[model samples]
Target: MGPTRVRDLSVAAVAVAALGYAVVTLMYRHFPPITALSGMSLAVVALAEAGWGFYVRAQIKDGHIGIGGGRLHPLVVARSVVVAKASAWVGAGVLGWWVGVLIYLLPRRSTLRVAAEDTPGAVVAACCALALVVAALWLQHCCKSPEEPPDDAEPAAE
Candidate 1:
């Protein structure tokens, strides 16, 4: 067996759960059709978004963080990061009934583009990606990084 990615596993689980919910909802459309379908749609949306989110993260991996040379170009990497962040939002919006508005509020065009490496396209891309991640995690209830460690904490007493 090989190591499995947590992000991939989570996305798959959400999708499977959504599929189950859909089957059950479909079985009872006559009893509560509209409400059930609406809920079902939310599940599906979340599954799709999470799947893509995991994919984006998988594509970037650890080595390309600063956007140096790699199989995925700097431009593509930037787009992937944006899409990942969007995926996170999509999941939240689906669960919370506000995905449509949130999608509308996002910037749909490239923040910047340059063929020549004269400018740090990759750098800008990385910054945008990091910002998006922070926003997404915040919206999803993840605690932000601690501001400062206890000054007197003695290196874990090791």
Candidate 2:
């Protein structure tokens, strides 16, 4: 497949955010308190992806061989690209959700103690989701093969 489009991601995020905002507006009172750690899992995943991106980039730059002298399989890179694309979409959706929640909560924070309490969690979650998107995109970039030179270029004279 081709590279993930930022335009598509943005549209998805906007749609999800709208939906999330509607849901939150309707059912926020029934939901439990949001904790700061609620989004930590996303952050953890982002970190893992970032590390993997670095490793894969190094391998690709070194001619598709690992630092340990093992060849990097094509399937492995394909799988990584899939994972990166999936994670990027997920992250965008989640980031939208948190943004929606924050939009709703921020306005009411002064009047509602619950909103004030949950604001921090939503902010943290949004940041974590953003990090995930960036890391996933980086991973996808790292997995790309180097560009080939134009076939029409003249050969160097001996």
Per-residue lDDT over 1-158 for candidate 1, one digit per residue giving the tens place of the 0 to 100 score:
12223375346435644654455335422333122233344344445544554544554443343455544455654454455455554443233222221122123224412212212332233233333334444323211122455688566665
> In angstroms, how far off is 28's CA in candidate 2?
0.5
lDDT of 2: 0.92
Which clashing pairs does model 2 show?
Answer: none
Q: Write the per-residue lDDT of candidate 2 for residues 103-146, one digit (tens) a residue.
A: 89999999999999999999999999999999999999999997
For candidate 1, give the lDDT of residue 156. 69
- lDDT of each structure? 0.38, 0.92
The deviation in Å at residue 121 for candidate 2 is: 0.5
Off by over 4 Å in 1: 1-33, 62-70, 84-158
Instruction: Give all TM-scores, in the order shown.
Output: 0.28, 0.92
Question: RMSD in angstroms, all models?
Answer: 19.9, 3.1
lDDT of 2 at 53: 94
